[model samples]
Target: MLQIITEKFFPPGERYETLHRAILYTNYRVMRGEKIITPIGYLLPSTGLHSLATLTCEMLEKQEKYPDGPKLGVFVATTGDDLLNDFAAVISFFLNVTCTPDPDLTRRLLLAERPSLGIEAVPSRFIRRMFDKDVHARDGEAAALTAFIKQLIGLERETFVGAMRAIRQFVIGSHRLADDLNLAYTLFVTSIESLAQGFDGHVAEWSDYDPRKRKKIDGALKDASDEVAAGVRDAILSNEHVALARRFRDFAMAHVAPSFFRVEAAGAQGPISGPDLPIALQQAYSIRSSYVHLLRDVPRQLTISGFPEATEVDDRKTLSFAGLSRLSRHIIMQFIARGRIVEREAFDYRRELPGIVTVKLSPEYWVASTGGFDHKTAPVRLAAFLEQITAAVLQHQKDAKLTDLGPILTMVEHSVSGLRKPSQRLPMLTLYFLFHQFAGPEFSCKQWPALFEKHKADFDAPTVESFVAHLITGNRVEWTLEQLEELHKTYFKTRHTASVTKIGLLLEAALSLYVAEVNRLAGNNARARALVAFAVDSHPGHAALRTYEASLPAELAEINWTGILLPPRPSSEGPSADPVPAA
Candidate 1:
């Protein structure tokens, strides 16, 4: 149970509080299988004290997120995350009123001294900051926990993991930091920074965002003085948020509604009644710097309601914590509603990798930006290289249970003749789906080579051979590179064309490198190294082979070798009655 560590305990009030020492005894019925004393109890103060702690505790303990929290090292209420979630409710209640709430004594809760527990009473940077912010708030954390929770759960996950951190700061500051009106007011602004930093990634293609030096080096820019340009470029590049305050105010103004500024609390008019959000929000962010770095403090009374005074449009206009909160929360909710991506400007990073090939095609296009490839246009010899890389990933997934696949047992019930027409893409894909499936243990040497040999005109032999090598290594299928042994004996003895010899070498290297990656991920470094060396030595200078060589460590490990790569089907129960297809 939690124990109060403070020397000064507020005197007991009229309502129910926690059991002795203000243990969150009310929130948790039973902790770690041991009974804690009392319920709806608080370590109270005056009239308001008992209601907040009691109501907050009851409401918090019943949330859907409660049971999902960590039960281990949990001392007192729930984990720190859970406790903060409970406290966030208090912030919601505060939103119901619009001012620097009257000074109320909030009691403390500390984990009891258990030498065995590793975590302290507080946890992680986010929670620790939150705990400190929550310590002094007297009121308003009562009703809105559900709304916040709803907003949190509904966010788009790709960016939500990031936005949640900023939201946590806003929640705590909205309630507790209000005690220091400036801290609370600036926090409303700081939360915007959190969103900006989390997702406002650089757009590399936008040359304007690039530093002058980079553009100069890349040959797209020039400056009056080389030294002046050189000295400041790196510094400019390093601070990703170049015009952070301006960007934040700009982005918030565009998204947050003006109506939010005019909102009234208990019939009291809000400060900045006219939508001068750009100036007001900008002033709020400037204050964040001094408060965070200089230990600056501002009077709480000035922010009770930012209105006619904040509306002056002057540099010194102070934003009320109440008004800023409305502005900040509205923008944050709009951000969430817009699917979690921040609206801020960015530098030096991006949300997604640029496409290798801009969609348009050119005759001599750089392969790096692959103008294009099609079955008809792609070089036939490179088929083996593509096959090896694709099979490596497929096999790794099947082995790791990351994917489930069934054993390959039979020939497809299809006519190879139908696959001959270039227009028949579906039939071609069917032939493709059949590629490695025939390489399973039972059909190892039989169906795969037989099918490919008959349909050689539709799909290349080198591609078939590469996948067969994958089957051998992946299943320990008791087969060696019979085709490689054949090619080794014949290639280059009498060079035909340069393309012919190069193709043979690349085919051998793709097989070697694919096996090398499989072995490396399997922890057979010796085998992996041998395979890598063989791959590099075989072609010696093939670009694709070398790229795969360097990527040995980057490949993700996969499992199972499950004997069942595909999830088994009920009708297809085991293998069919005969290992051969009816076709």
Candidate 2:
């Protein structure tokens, strides 16, 4: 019967496959309750095919056994609707034909004749009354046993309600169940969205003669309803109902009400026009807000030193903006865990942390009138202060003095890359500046590269934003783009032709010689003129040769007759002795 029903609805196989996965996922949710805000992945829906196959197969076997008997036309007259109403009926009828003589429970159920004899009746009844304080249960073990036994005793109206209530409470209190609810809700909603995309109001109708197949699907949907109701009940019981209500009110006031204009602007594409979109979005927002304010604890403490007082607006926006962003992240995580949202190993929002990013979470940006401490000045001054503090710390770390300057220079070199010419400090750049400022520019220039290289492997790749975190926490290196570039160069030499290398080496030697000659000039004014002229030269190679040639007096310039390095085998063997210049 079960196989028959399952196959009827799951005809294409894909539906069954998707639904099987979904059922497994929902079972997990029924197990996890309120912590539903946790992440969950996607789930597929069920098809009613297999259930019908089981029913048909059972009837065929039963008819073969009773061929000469009164049961010949009994099952043939039974419709899918009748089979659905009495789920246990098919199993009992089969047992009568196929089993050894008769099974005890099968005989009992077949003879009972009322809904009380329904398969789930007894067990539901027992569980309902067992957990009550007034109920005389000998021990926890006894209570559990009694609950299971009584649950099977048949569902009188009171017992059914009692059983549901107990199950609901149990699910609510179970952390696992809470997690499932959040997961399932997110996954279900996402699946529904996907399903809606293909809906377009087109559906295939089954033949009237195939009514049996319809019954199986309806039965599956009914079972799904039971699961959903159980999950909802558990979810409701897990959290403070009043708090949820308060959250709804707050979300409406802060987001929905204020953002109604945006939705109107969106027109047909908006949530207002969406099917059940408002409720889903609002519920998501409410749950997230509640989790943030009540669980994750956003709107962190703000300590202001030397300020007169913090205004009410400060606290209000704290709860609104920062709080909202945090809640959004939490909700996203919940959906991901539930299989509703796709998970990425890393998330980059770009702007995060006030000290690190110039933009705070507030809607406001630059403030013009706060004297020395407006919004613009605040980040700048804070950066400068951080720089000084880092410099001071490094100064005290006298042990680093013995380290090679190569690594230190590398840090300073890297720090320069982050410099924003206008304000001069990028958020991340400030850290490098602070490192140089505190460790003393010299230490930053010398030790950072070694420190960075030493700890490179320890970096976390899951969320690469922690690069800043690693540096701050390790306190091993001061960083700057200039130093980083130099380090990179040191580690990776460019591979060019040998000719290029030779030219580079020769040019460096020549430039060094020029600097030396200028330093030996007679007067400061003369030295300044020579240096300035060299600096202003448009052609470096030309100016360098010119500078070399003009650096000495005319008498020195004229002595080119062959003696230097034996002047390449002069054919004349010229007796040119100019005190032969040293090689």
Candidate 3:
């Protein structure tokens, strides 16, 4: 624990913009909740949180920060900093444990201290800025809302903290992206998925296949080679969408609240009782899958957030986003309350490490914005290069005909070789997303006629822009210049869509770096300089490219490539933005 607490720091002249952290004790108290102790101190038993004022506040006589009115909840953290995340998490864990889903729950989500006019700064980096002030939840409208919470529950201190942390983030996300309904809904589901991953009895079922056939299939795989068996196993389990959907729905059903069907939703929204409940629940997960893999839209009712918000999709598969949001919170609450213990050693304390790389559940699994990174941290900046490339691959996986996936694997293999483990925030899936963000759906890219030759390989690598500008351009195929040029235009250029997204900009910059490396290796220093210069321009403030440019031979480093025009090469992979979720 960093014993020295400090208020949110702002640039010298922006002290007025500096928001102070104030812990106001609300009238609400935790019921059946016991005191929780951490290394530095213990949370007031009723609140399940400890408030430590910053040193700056102790020394200065600052103007009043928050309003004089009383706020919501047992624990309300009014911070203009990252610490609000903790407030959300603690409140979520507390509510979950206590089974007190107050109808005014949304009021309790006041984590950030934003100016009433809204956040003024144009974000220059990754950040988590505001808290949702949506109408407070009306848990009483749904009978099952708080039905599952048990009395006198005992959860391991570690399990309690971990659940709190994960929920805080996902809940924040649900509110943050509430406007982008699909992504917001997905985040809500992912929050539950994160909790489900390590759930007890979370058996690694190969697939939800017929048991009779499954037994034979298991036998068939008995003597198979490791790679062959593993591949087969993966193929068999590829329909995890169903398993996950059923897992969610079944989890809900297995613990059906005693009063779940006692009443109808307040609005004329379709019924979620009897068969409708499970169907809507399953459909919620189904809608989540559609948005995830195909970017599909949600049912109309689900898109609009409202009171008595649970909508029945009688004509289609559906659960209102609000309905799902409330459901997810309940599931999480029940999950944390039911989970009495998790092995103390099971916690990934690495998350608490002081390293610049702070691993979080992907907002892309309930991931959130990471903070505290700066130019001094080389790996975080360098990791962005690969991170963006992974984003590109995932974005184009379906349309880019980018079947030459092996090249990026080699690129990642080469790039990550000397990287420290801490710097490797890259998720395990970077076939660009192998670093993070990629969910390993079978992506589509144009395959050369002879490429089915790779069917037996580990994965169908969506190779670098179909090998036209692949760094190892000639490694596998003998492409005549004409074929290379034609393929490059038809696939990489024509099929590519323009993107103005932040991720798109970074992907464009990364591809420029990708080409720069290729050109440099090819001894085309001038072109390499042009590419690097373009990359630097596209993604300003990148440390890796800047360092590489600074280290250039003194004479060449002095040469300006900015004004010089270079012929466009047929092999150049240009910028195109495809929406890639966070890695």
Candidate order (TM-score): 3, 1, 2
- The local distance difference test score of model 3 is 0.41
Candidate 2 lDDT by residue in tens digits, 1-583: 2223222212232211111111210111112111111011121222323211111111110111233444543222223332222222211111111111113332232222332321222211112221111222122432332333233222332222233332222222221111232332233222222222222232223222135644665555565677784564454344422333333333333323323334322421112222333343454444445544565321223111111111123322222221222222222222222221211122221121112345332111211112343223334433333332222222222221221223223433455444434223232233333344334343444444554454343332211112223332343233343343343233224313221111122222222233323344423344434533443342354443455445655232222211110113435532211111111
- Kindly list the per-residue Cα lDDT of model 1 for residues 1-583, writing each as its tens digit: 1111110121332222222222231111112222211221222222233422222222222211223453663222233333334333333322322111222322222221221132222211112222232333323332233344444444444455445555666765655442345565567777777776555553323243446545655463254376665555554556554666666766776666645544433343435544455666667777788788887764444433323234332445556554565556667766766664332322211122122233633211221122242323222223332333333333332321111111211212243334445333322332234334532454343345565556544423333333434443353433235543344335434335332312344445545655555565667777766766676777776554455556645443432222212222345333222122211
The TM-scores of all predictions, comma-separated, are 0.35, 0.16, 0.38
Judge candidate 3 at residue 10 and give its lDDT.
14
For model 1, the superposed segments whose C-alpha errors exceed 4 Å read: 1-53, 56-148, 174-182, 200-239, 261-270, 273-275, 296-316, 340-583
Backbone atom clashes (below 3 Å) for every candidate? 26, 87, 25
Point out the worst 10-residue segment of candidate 1 by lDDT.
Answer: 1-10
Error of 1 at 345 (Å): 27
CA deviation > 4 Å runs, candidate 3: 1-84, 92-162, 204-242, 259-271, 312-317, 342-583
Please state the error at residue 512 of candidate 3 in Å. Answer: 18
Each candidate: RMSD: 18.1, 31.5, 19.3
lDDT against the true structure, each candidate: 0.41, 0.28, 0.41
- TM-score-best of 1 and 3: 3
